[model samples]
Target chain A: MSQGNMNLTLKVWKQKNKNEKGRFETFDAKGISPDMSFLEMFDVVNEHLISSGKEPIAFDHDCREGICGMCSMYINGRPHGPKQGVTTCQLHMRSFKDGDTIVVEPWRSAAFPVIKDLAVDRSSFDRIMASGGFVSINTGNAKDANNILIPKYDADDAFNAAACIGCGACVAACKNSSAMLFVSAKVSQLALLPQGKIEKRDRVLNMVKQMDEEGFGNCTNTGACEAECPKSISLENIARMNREYLKASLT
Target chain B: MSEKSFFLSSSIGKKISMGLTGLFLISFLIVHVSVNSCIFINDGGITFNAAAHFMATNPLIRLIEIGLFAGLILHIIFALLLTLENKKARPIGYEKINGSANSNWYSRSMGILGSLLLIFLVVHLAHFWIDTKIAVFTGKADKHNTFNEMKEVFSNWYIVALYLIGVGSLLFHILHGFQSAFQTLGLNHKKYTPIIKKIGLWFSIIVCLLFASMPVAIFTELIK
Candidate 1:
């Protein structure tokens, strides 16, 4: 749908740091090429701001491709603009009209305090990952991958769970700011594999405990996380983690 | 934190309680609908009265009655707490929001439906339970003639309409709650979830319809 250039208005959030109050600053993004990526469009606007001797808006982004879950922005209320299954980086200007005014904001959650205009400190995810999101295997010898002989279905399910890129979109999209989808993805990715089975008990238990400590909300099964996920991760991972957690708690 | 306290305090832990209590309440609905359906025997409420009499008199069921109340109370308390916390989580809301693209209306409106059900429960208990239980124990009401009380209650068209509205709310609540309870408990399987969802829909419809029909039938004089 990329076509000719278009003029548009943009309302971007601006904050000096976590402590400072933020506000949306409007700008005229004139002659924006429809073919340009959303990030590129942002770059154009930032360059214009720089040339005009104004403080450019700060937003987090890396590896303009969608794979790196680094780029996070709430555009017009959705986690990553109007599209589904696409990160903010992959979002194209084609999704907008000639004069559309796009509203951009950072992920809002108690656990993810805002660091800048559109960047939130997502280290809570790293804390959850450290709390049993790993398996211990010796470095001395390498085992055959086929020796584990996981079923194709189980392997596929594990791969799906592992597809989560640790994006805070799930938290941002959830009405309660729940991190269940993110935590569940991590738990299920390990729980589905034999190599990860050894630490399954402590893993689910520890991760859940850490998740709670981070002040994330509970999963009410609203299914918003699964819907807004760029990777289209299934809600099944949450259920799987729940099963793993229940077993771990009982044992 | 202690394991028990953690389970009680944590979001997921409270969710588990919601599931467990919700499932317990579902069982109560099954028993209630079954007992109430006895009025369909078309024998002037003979079977219905006998079942109600037995339920009120049997010490075993009486003990279970207390447990049922506890389950209901716990369910209500946890639900209210969770809803409040969920609301607090999103203190600042979007101006141009679109939630319909993501989740079902019923899933999102559970708090409102639950509140309606809560109101319905209070009214229902006042209408039948309080009067019947007080009279039965005080030897002022015949335990075997509770069907007459049912008739008297349904005689008012407003009460019947209120009951129908309550059952309507219940239908929507259970349609989401049944599968959600199991999902929260981690009983979900790729193969079984669809089946469970289907069963949940049918179960809610049948149970709520049966409950609604009692009031309608009594008001219409179809059962008389």
Candidate 2:
């Protein structure tokens, strides 16, 4: 069981498009390096498929360093694999045993239909973001950083929330396919800042209305989304969003 | 949006209503468990019947009982609607999923546990509640005392088994529901949330253990 010669079985979901049915296709991933990233392993497998005159599996990736949030593969029944606080691009093959049969699939949500083998059309997130994930400002140069006197703790929390890369991992991991963690992180990042205060009411109201209309499920506070988030987004953002929504709705 | 549609159409609003109603039902459990504990006084239904009779005859208690029913009804309604909506959110099922890796089983199965509790409630209301509360409401004078009813109901091993299963389901249900209700209300904080979760664990254990022990004690003739 040397670190280098790790061979494994990969059962990947293969879907032609949103309208077509999907099925799991197994591939023999051979001569995989332990140090290689999960996506790199996929690259090796896709290389094998292409060499055999088979269709290359379509997936999404950018900034292979983890910040872009594009590489989403529900590996071994966990979004972004077994590692905590790491995206698929950051996950290493050393986490799995040499003889393991890994299961990989696209994000399963009605709001995020599978566009290809492992890529989903997460444009629903874009629509929700468009509804209100912005702060209004005058047409001028950006304000100086030190001008706004935000508490250090508030800034840190906002930063933590702002770390969200709009990945569909939260929705993928949720039993109900709820986007609360994603939306809450988006909402909290803005709400904690003074700039977000101007349109706080309408922002939450419009964003939530759009969220509901997009067919995402309800949050039951299971904390799965937070657990699966690569950025380590806290469930407190969800509670904060709930409070903000309540305040906006009532007033 | 109008007040009615906001609660009906919005997901967060439905969750908020569920949380509020769930908290109300939780408080009622305190009253219920406390009254049920009176049977432990073991004076052969004297003190137990007195508390039961007072609960039945008091006007304020009757009004609170109405509110309790309303709370229970709302809790059930929202739970059902949300369950259906959540099911629809994932139109296509996952080929393979590991739910336990990310969340506790009870938290994910609230709908199933709640349905079990609802079934238990019907059997329970028929056994004791119809005997006392419904009798008082319908002006029927003769019925068994609350203590004797407990003794009789628990005398049958089958009925006692059902009660334990009901209490067991409630333990897991409350274990998740208590802290969940608070979080849904946006009351989560780093400092306070840990305390809330600890309290919720202890409360669920204490309440469910007390309830579960009742049926076992009666069946074993430990309290009679």
CA-based DockQ, model 2 = 0.62
Residue runs of model 2 more than 4 Å from their true location after superposition: A1-3, A141-143, B1-5, B138-144
lDDT of 2: 0.90
Q: What is the lDDT of residue B169 in candidate 1?
A: 94
* lDDT at A73, model 2: 91
Give per-residue CA lDDT, model 1, range A112-204, as digits (tens). 888988888999999989887567776867877677689999999989888898888999888888899999999888888888988888888
* True lDDT of residue A85, candidate 2: 93
Which candidate comes out best when scored by TM-score? 2
Best by lDDT: 2
Clashing pairs in 1: none
Candidate 2 per-residue C-alpha lDDT over B9-127 given as tens digits, one digit per residue, 9 for 90 to 100: 79999999999999899998899899889878878778878888888888999899999999999999888888888889999877778889899999999988998999999999999
lDDT of 1 by residue, B1-224 (tens): 22322567767778999999999999999989999999999798889888887887788999999999999999989987887776666555554556787888888788889899999999999988887688778976454477888898999999999999899999999899999988888887878999999999999999998999999999999988
Task: Summarize candidate 2's per-residue lDDT along A126-241 as a digit string, tens digits.
Answer: 99998884678777897786977988999999999999999899999999999999999988998999888888777888888888989999999898998889999999999999
- Per-model TM against the reference: 0.93, 0.96
Quote the RMSD, in angstroms, for model 1. Answer: 2.5
